[model samples]
Target: MRILNLLKIAFKAIVLNKMRTLLTMLGIIIGVASVIAMLAIGEGSKASIRETISAMGSNMVTVRPGADDRGPARGSGGDVQTLIYKDYEKIKEEVSLINYITPVVNGGGQVINGSNNWPSTIYGVNPDYLNIKVVGLQSGSMFTDAEVQSASKVVLLGQTVVDNVFPDEEPVGKMIRFNNIPFKVIGVLEEKGENTFGQDQDDVVIAPYTTVQKRILAIDYLNQIMASAVSEDDASEVVEQVTEILRSQHKLLDSEDDDFTVRSMEELISTFSSTSEMLTILLVAVASISLLIGGIGIMNIMYVSVKERTKEIGLRMAVGGKGSDILMQFLIEAILISITGGLLGVLLGLTATVFIENFLHWPTSVALYSIIVSFAVCAITGIFFGWYPAKKAAALDPITALRYE
Candidate 1:
C-alpha cells in the first residue's frame, strides 16, 4: 500500500473509535502541559531574582567591621567598631579601580513634618553614595560635599518615606525633623520596589554620614562602607585592593585576622543564580517523570488496540495487504494522536502560564526551547510506545487472526 493510503486508513481507524482515541491522547496532553508549565515558572523566577538584584546596584561592594575582643570577651562578627571614617577616605584616595566610596552610619527614627509622622531608617552617607547605589532623584538634588563637611541637616527621602510624610505636599526644601533634629529635605529618591530578599528599597531617608555620627548616633566609628568598582570585570581586583588597604589601616600583622569583611554584588548574584538554576533543574526532572508515565500509557493502549483489531488486520492481509503496510498504519496512527495532543498541550500550557501570572501574580516565562523539547518528547514517545504493538500486529498469522472471535 502507498504511504498516503496507510495514513488514510490509520486516521479512519482512530476516528471510528473517537472516544478511545481521545482518552489515549489525554496522557500525552497532560505530560507535555506539565513540562512546559514547570519550566516556565522556574525560568521566570530566575529572571525575576536577577532583575531585583541588578536594580539594587551595579558592580557594588560593601565593607563592614568584623569581630573584636573587649578585655577577653569576644564580640560577634559585624558588631565590631573597627571600620572607621579613615578607612573610607583611604579606599577613595588609594584604590584606582574603585569608582565611588562612602562611609555609612545607620540609624532609625520618627520623621515628622507637622501633623504627618512616619518611622523610617536614616542612612548616613556621602554624596558618592547616590551614584554607588545607583539611586536617582525623583525631585531636587543630592547634598554637596560642603554640606557633608559641615554636617548640615539636609536629607534625601525615599519614595515610601515621601508618600507617608509628604503625602499632601511637595517634599523638597521642606523641613522634616529626625529624632527631634530639624533636617531640610534635599531630594526624593526614585521608586525602587523591593530587593531579592523582600525588603522595601524605598522606605527610608538618606543624610550626611557626619551628621548621623556626630548629631544622631553620636559615634566615631562607621557602621559600614559602600563602594562601587569601575567596572564589573574589575570588581574582584577592587575587592582585593580594598581588603589590603583596610588591613594596613587597621595595623593588622600578617598572622592577625582582619578586622573587616568585604562583599561584592557580583558574588551575591552568582550565588543566587546558581541556587535558582539548581531549583529549575530539579523541577524539570520532576516534571519529566510524567512524560515517562504518559509513554507507558500509550504503550498499553496500543497493545489493546492491536488485540481488538485482529479481525480487521486479518481481512486486510487476506486482501493483499503486506505486513509492512499494517505496521506503517498502526505507527502512523500513534504518531498522529501524539502530534495532535502535543499541539493542544502547547496551547494549554501557554494559557496556564498566563493565568498563573494574572491570578497568582507569579512570574512565568515560556521559552522556545521548552516548546521544542516538549514536542520532540511527544514524537519520541509515540515511536517508542507504538513500535512494539505494531510489530506484534504485523507478525500475526492471517489464518489464526481470521479464526479469532
Candidate 2:
C-alpha cells in the first residue's frame, strides 16, 4: 500500500473514536507539559542566581573573622571580632590583584526623618565600597576620601531606605538620624531588587566605616572586609594573597588555624550552580514519570484497539493488504496521536510558564532545547509503545477472524 493510503486509513480510524484517541493522548500531553514547566523553572532560577551574584560583582571576595572553637562548642563567625581596620589597610597595600578594598561594619537602628521613621540596616564602609560592589548612584555623589578620613557623619541611602524615609522629598543633602545621631544623606544608590537569598539589596544605608565603627557601633574591630579583584581570573589569586596576609598579621603558626576566613565569588557561584543543576535534574526526573505513564497508556489503548479491529485486520489481509501494511497503519495512528498531543503540550507548557512567572512572581525560562527534547520523547514513545500492538494486529489470521461473531 502507498504511504498516503496507509496514513489516510490510520487517520480515519482515529477520527472514528475521537474521544478514545483524546483519552489515549492525555498522558503524553500531561507528561510533556510537566517536563517543560519544571525545566523552565529550574533554568530560570539558575539564571536569576547568576545575575544576582554577578550584579554583586563576580570578582569580589569577602573576608570575615573565623569561628572560635571552644572544646566542641564553636562560636559563629560573627561572634569573633578578630578582623581589625589595620587588617584592611594591610590587604589594600599588599595585594596587587585587589583593585578595591573596604572594611565593613554593620548595625541596625530605627532611622527617623521627621514624621516618617523606618527600621533599617546601617553599613559602615570606606569610599571604595560602592565601586567594589559595582553599585551606582541614582543622584548626587559618593563621599570623598577626605570625608571618610575625617570620619564625617555623611551617608548614602539605598532606594528602599529613600522610599521609606523621604517618600515625598529629595533625599540628597537631607538629614536622617540613626539612633538619634544625625547624618547627612550624600547620595542615593540605584535600585537593585533582591539577592538570591531573597534579601533586599536596597534596604540599607552606607557610611564611612570609621564613622560607623567609632560613632555608632563604638568599636575598633572591623565586622568584615569586602574586596574586588582586578579581573575574574585574578579572584582566586587575590583570595590566596588575602589569606596569607591575614594569617601572618594574626601571628598564626603553621600548626594553628587562621583567625580569619576568605571567600571568593567564584566559589559561591560554583556552589549555587551545582545545587541548581541538581535540582533541575531531579525535577526533570520526576516529570519524566508522567511521560512513562503516558507511554504505558498508549500501549494499553493500542492493545484494546487491536482486539476491537481484529475482523477489520483479517479483511484487510484477505483483500491483498500486506501484514506490514496493517502494522504501519496502526503504528501511524499511534504516532499521529502522540505528535498531536506533543504539539498541544508545548503550547500548554508555555502558557503554564507564563502564568507562573506573572502570577507567582517567580522566574521561568523555556529553552529551545527543552521543546525539541519533549517532541523527540513524544515521537519515541509512540513508536516504542505502539510496536507490540501493531505486531499483534498484523499477526491475526483471516480464516479464524472470519469465523468470529
Indicate the TM-score of model 2: 0.72
Question: 226-334, model 1: which lDDT tens digit per residue?
Answer: 9999987788888899999999999999998877888888888788879988988988887788877877888888899999999989999999889999999889988
Give candidate 2's whole-model lDDT.
0.91
What C-alpha lDDT do the candidate models reach, one value each?
0.89, 0.91
Give lDDT: candidate 1, residue 108: 82
Off by over 4 Å in 2: 1-5, 41-60, 66-100, 105-124, 131-134, 144-154, 159-169, 174-184, 191-205, 208-222, 228-241, 248-251, 264-286, 318-320, 357-363, 396-405
TM-score of each: 0.76, 0.72
For candidate 1, the lDDT comes to 0.89
Cα distance off (Å), candidate 1, residue 186: 2.3
Model 1 residue 162 distance off true place after TM-score fit, in angstroms: 4.0
Q: Write the per-residue lDDT of candidate 2 for residues 285-313, one digit (tens) a residue.
A: 99899998998999999999999888888
Task: Report the Cα RMSD per candidate.
Answer: 4.6, 5.1
